[model samples]
Target: MPDYEPIVGRYLTIEVAGEACRIHVEEAGDGIPLVCLHTAGSDARQYRHLMCDPAITDHYRVIAFDMPWHGKSNPPVGWRDREYSLTTELYKDTIMAFCRAMELRHPVIMGCSMGGRVVLHLALEQADRFRAVIALEGADRLEPYYELDWLHRPDIHGGEVCAAIVSAQVAPQSPDEYRWETLWSYMQGGPGIFKGDLYFYWYDGHFDDRSPLIDTDKCPVYLLSGEYDSSCTPERTAATASRIAGAKATVMEGIGHFPMSENPALFRTYILPVLDEIRGAG
Candidate 1:
């Protein structure tokens, strides 16, 4: 809905472990560098509204990128799952490797949903590289409703289930446009990408008790939540944040899972300031 200048985001290839993964990084604005990670199946376009905002640009530089199998990145052709879990490990390595490649030391990392999960992993694994982290609408565990007897729920699709749950959170404004874009972008990932991501969701146990790995004292952590987030409820997110020392938690009222998309104005007003505060502290 927002018109942005057609600036070409840079593409670079980084090797994670042994697999070559593609990354797209957009550098804009001024001041401290803020690296934003996109949610699962979402690309850098998720932060388009934020990137377009001069308020954020005036204070800090925004760097956003797409993951290996999302957006402009290509997926492995005819890739099938063996027993390898591709949920957290791939993203964790990719983000860390990207920072190492780009020489982004101690960046303020912020992410939403799956992106938030990735941030959590990074904070736990490489706390020194990140000054602060804000995990919005994210949890260390999968949505209980989605994992209700995962062994017997062959009829349920996590992607469809998540979409339906998030749909209920946004009211008044219709998701017709969002729905179309999501499906279009998701399907653009092709069959292999879909299979890999879904397989991770179905079989991986990455969400189980990651708090032990988190070092809240060393890295200031924050968990932000929309009041109506159906996927990760405010209570759940807050509880996860509370488990870590000095981790802050806030429940944003009158918003949904993707508050930045649903209400960009409110996000700029309520959320952007948090980034500013963290930047100042840094």
Candidate 2:
């Protein structure tokens, strides 16, 4: 066996949603485009492995971007006066705008958590626009929205507090190294962004018995849940998948929320076959 070295990823600024969002963008390999959407509060940096891994980049022009308020991106104008709040409308608009601005023709989209929740909207609203969608820890409706009214209190470090909440959700079986890496993102988010994202993830994102709106004919939809994710259980994801025609669902064992970064090596084992299936579909 030999040491594996990853190709360096690019850091670029891409304009999106009528703002000069100085976002971090990474791209590698060349085939069909694969646009990755990160979890709330986290950045494109989460997909560093996928951007660097030849196994995936070899077959797709993989790209990931940090939202304007997250990662290395600059906040849009007027953002300095108020707290950052992500809405369902803005979320989908930004995603759609990004792909169009980048000219990513029929790109395969993959997202987790809040990103996962919005991906369902993308599939239902514009299936012909994308080749396929992979939603990790995804569900039609994310429930039991939490209230962290004290998140902005002077004594509270909202980012750290949010991280602690997620730490409780990390699967016990995940490797120590993987577990910590995933939790690190939560600690790094901008003030109040994590809680704001939850407004959409846990509350406004609900589709409410509307999973049937997703048409697998125009675009293939695959929903994957980590075995230990209590937020969006595997059973919940499967039941949602069952409502959509031609959709498929699977539970990745020994994993939890944030599967991609929590355990990239293990998560890849589950994703490879789906990539092949998408390739065959093309």
Candidate 3:
């Protein structure tokens, strides 16, 4: 018999912002819903390890989806008519729509990087809709570290440039195989998609003033940042956690921006306790 993984992949058609979008989703395990969001320029594949791990699946159903325009998810109709720029409203609406469409009642929502930042918004606006929120490598607002124009410039190879740029964000201690695997996802992103995602990451997702408003009593927020992540530094995550009452933040030693993808095994050490806490609370 051929070796097989328990994970399943499917496509779901949903409407967002008056346009139809076909989203690619992968899921595994069975129990409380654990909805995961991937990083900017990447897709649900980032959560492959989590979905496949029996330790987690035995207690939680892990569901990860590629936002339209990334991975196997196709962009909405007439995407060519306008530039693809992810805004705060669009990101939040897409997530909410997906949750409601799937009938995921009070699922535990977790996100990394761009996904990480949006969980803050979700906690602030839709706290009652989720049991808890987990953010990895997220911050209130990020200082622009790279030129967005370079990501989609006519002269640059978008794939190569993107992969190279994010390469440094991976920790040096991560296994070579997984580190390259993480970078490979960046290389495969559609032209301008990575840059478009950053539009929300760096500009539209500002929470410096808004994070303090999230009431942890209603919706708990747990933040984990990899020490090596220069983009969303550990300091920034701690500061954001500090502002939110009852929020918890921890720095994962020897990890980097793409914790789940770059080093899933190590990431597990930090995440398992959080999962246990959520399960205990539930």
Q: Which of the numbered candidates is closest to the native, going by highest lDDT?
A: 3
Per-residue lDDT tens digits of candidate 3, residues 82-193? 8999999999999998998788988999999999999999999999999999999989888997689999988999989999999999999999999999999999999999
What are the per-model C-alpha RMSD values against the true structure?
Answer: 4.3, 2.5, 0.7
* Top TM-score prediction, candidate number: 3
Clashing residue pairs, backbone N/CA/C < 3 A, model 2? none
Two-way lDDT contest, 1 vs 2, winner: 2
Candidate 3 off by > 4 Å? none
Q: Is 1 or 3 the stronger prediction by lDDT?
A: 3
lDDT value, residue 151 of candidate 3: 96
- Model 2, 28-131: lDDT tens digits are 77898988888877888778777677778789888888877887777777887878778888788888877876888889999988888788888888888889
TM-scores, one per candidate = 0.81, 0.93, 0.99
| Model 2 regions lying over 4 Å from their true place | 1-17
| TM-score of model number 2 | 0.93
